[model samples]
Target: RVDGEILKGWPTPTGKLEFWSRTLHDWGWPELAIPKYIKSHIHPENLESDQIPLITTFRVPVQIHTRSANSKWLDEIAHTNPLWIHPIDADRVGISKTGDLVRVETELGYFVLKSWITEGIRPGVAACSHHMGRWKPEGHKGQRLGISTVALNQEGSEWSLTPRKGGEPFASSDPDTMRIWWTDLGVHQNLTHAVHPDPISGQHCWHQAVRICPAKEGDRAGDVSVDTGKSQAAYEKWLAMTRSADRYSPDGTRRPYWMLRPVRPERDAYHLPLKTESAEV
Candidate 1:
């Protein structure tokens, strides 16, 4: 079967390969109706002198953190998430060698982790796999296979997590617990990440503009600090970026019906609710 013609020109409303979106134009995003690159929050012009773009968009194998049928071998292979930094950035940040602890400061706060200085990554960007930072609070029961027990503390809106210890062999019912050897399980970097939803696509933007530096005097690897208040503030900041659909639906519909909908509602249900006196409120 042909791709376009067989479907009578793609499923889109335009019935053609559209570089421009009529729905977007009528639904409050005229400038973004055409395909274009909007500067991200981490764009060079948007960043400070010491800031660099941190790419947190990718994930590692599920076995690195999540249970894979409780298979012990998968957990042994891939478990640590180190910050991938180019040698140039490494030297610039005073990371003399690999495994040196580094602090990656974000809009809300920072997380510390061992650095893996390598040429595998871009010089100007830092990357950490989101897969391996699984954690459990201090005095809380957590899986021993792929997590670090951490001390969790909170002061008003600010919160901090410090790994009390990394993975170590522990006596338990399972014999494999004694065979466990790895220590670096990774840090919880997700907490420090601020929310920034794309105005048009509505997908969460995962790229972060951050400051990378050598770990501070008291900083330990797998340490994370954040301000919940700042995280909430960031959510609102990106929320304001969106153009409200109710104000600009050309046909008073919630969204373009032509697009794929996993759970499609009745045609009439797509229309905006009747504007009552309270609707304006």
Candidate 2:
């Protein structure tokens, strides 16, 4: 509309570009109905003395998402998501070497990864690629260039991942699979991450505040340790932050009809049937 090509107006209910979202107010989030500043979950001020900001949003220039893991040339250049730590933070954490293994502990669990100490990253902040770290179960199919074969074991409320094998030279159809030299294809760090659903927007908060420490005994590179019980607790903690549709629906509908969906469902499907309590109760 700024270009005034057609001048039809905007898509909102008001038929104008919305500065204040009436839909959000009617749907139970009045504070966020208008454009305003909100504190980020990973704001550095919210961090404890021991914690540092973990920037997971950055990916290598060559690597795309999981699909690019199969690209041999890309994997050769950016195979691992090394923990990019600044020299000051590295020295504080007792990391004197660039390739030293470091344990990054999140709210749910911890994963060990190699630290790349450099001045590129800011002090008191560390970053790892959002890409990389693709894994497959021992018997599952995985990419040849940048995937690790691992065993996912679960016992009760505990889950553990053990690396059975990493990318290695093996004869295969492409013959490049046999030329695979890198054994460390990065770590599956996401498995240890806790869900961080936004209370109003209903989006997941990706950045995390984590504590970095020197790798302890028995901690191997790419090793991930998680307790399903803790993860469940974290899930519940984030779930409580959301305003459920059942409690906040504006017109007994699951979602706003005007919202765009790739495959739209029937209008009747949007309504939720009224529940009646049984007399036996």
Candidate 3:
């Protein structure tokens, strides 16, 4: 059993099976084995129905799959989780640029995040790369270079490095010691995820459609503004449908499932709703 339903054998779900068959048939390919009892659930009516919401997975540059993104060294290479949206969609909602903060909103909820507007995504749909933003304490340590190097000058009997205010030279070695500061710490962008569900799988997609906008004047940099009334309501709706325990088989052991586990219960409130805003680019 999976998701409280029994799967009798090794056949693809009715919906996916039909899609494959139709796709093959339309392309002039051979028809594959499709069980007779399993009705073709893909109908023009269903395709046109409102049941299916936009579905997409996120991708980022620095991380490979889920494993590397969690490593300290790799995280420093790319710090933020950027949302990818098509230019047309971005234009429709007012998203402007790669660095601009944008909000994406759906019926279930909304989130505010930095936008990476491009033509890669399909119009009316957006994507966010998972991994990237990470906040582990040790990870913070890797962000800044601890010690710096400096240049020193030696003139006749006098040798000096740049002096600190109200103090002697920062350091004076046999060869003048100079100091310079450097950093390797990168930004974490994963804080923008919110709880949203896919209608078909009854599983949370963890991404939300939203609008993007500039931080208001005098607003702290990186702070997002969310409508509490809307966010809270959306969260409650998701909570109602989420399963308390992992799905299991009829015999009580865990079922063979292929999906990622939910990270935690935290949502961002700063994103704009898709219908209300346009891409700023």
Candidate 4:
């Protein structure tokens, strides 16, 4: 079949690398069928006048996700997560300089973290490491190498996590515990972050739309506040953005069989129950 033919064409309905995805079109996302520019949730137009995007994709090179705390040496290399803000954004937000605390408010709540003024980050958006900000409650047993002992309190829908202690050397039976030297384990940022799901991909959206300002009067560094009620509402709002497969599945299946999924059901199980109408006179 060589009329300038494919030895083994790409995996798709067309048997080729696809610029236009029929699956996306058939699966309730016609808008995303073609490879074209689509505005993201954090597109400038989607942000409010006072809001800027909070990028949490950065992680310290020496650190591993969640496992960094296991290594005292790695924790010593990088434990603290300061909000990396551009110098201009800092000044605009009333931050005097680096080491200043800034309150980053999302729809659910805010977290107070030290501001790091540098050109290393792009202007108009702030960044923080997703790997840091590990914390534990005062009496709770957690890793000693990289965590803050915070007092977590809740009232109604409001929740607050305030650090009682940062990383520091402490007398313990283990010599490694005595060797602790750093004092900034970072702030617990997830407490203030709400669930954001991509409507189509269904992946957790981590880029946050946030308002940055100088920390409030009572705010301490590493302080986090969240309204759980607002958190729930954010979930529902994003959930509505999606199109239900039950209604949109042209083949009456939960998903197209060609699409690879980790766990899947039989063809019959992919179908929705048939709807019935009551008899009328």
The lDDT for every candidate, in the order shown, is 0.84, 0.84, 0.41, 0.85
Which residue pairs in model 4 clash with each other?
none
Please name the candidate that would achieve the greatest lDDT relative to the true structure. 4
Over 4 Å off in model 2, which ranges?
Answer: 1-6, 139-143
Clashes of 4: 0
lDDT of 3 at 182: 16
Query: Which TM-score value belongs to model 4?
Result: 0.91
**Per-residue alpha-carbon lDDT of model 1 for 155-273, expressed as tens digits?**
99999998887888888898888998888888878889998888777888999999999999999888999999999999999998877768877888877777787898989988888
> Residue 10, candidate 4: how far off, in angstroms?
3.4
Task: List pairs with backbone clashes in candidate 2.
Answer: 170-178
In terms of TM-score, the best-performing candidate is 4
Please, what are the lDDT tens digits per residue for candidate 3 over residues 143-250?
222111222344543322221111012333422222322122222223333455632245556533344444344432223223445546766776765332233122
Q: What are the per-model C-alpha RMSD values against the true structure?
A: 3.0, 2.5, 18.8, 2.4
| Residue range 15-79, candidate 2, lDDT tens digits | 88898898999999899888887777677678888998888787779888887877888888888
Q: Which pairs of residues collide in model 1?
A: none
In candidate 1, position 242 carries an lDDT of 78
Error of 2 at 28 (Å): 1.4
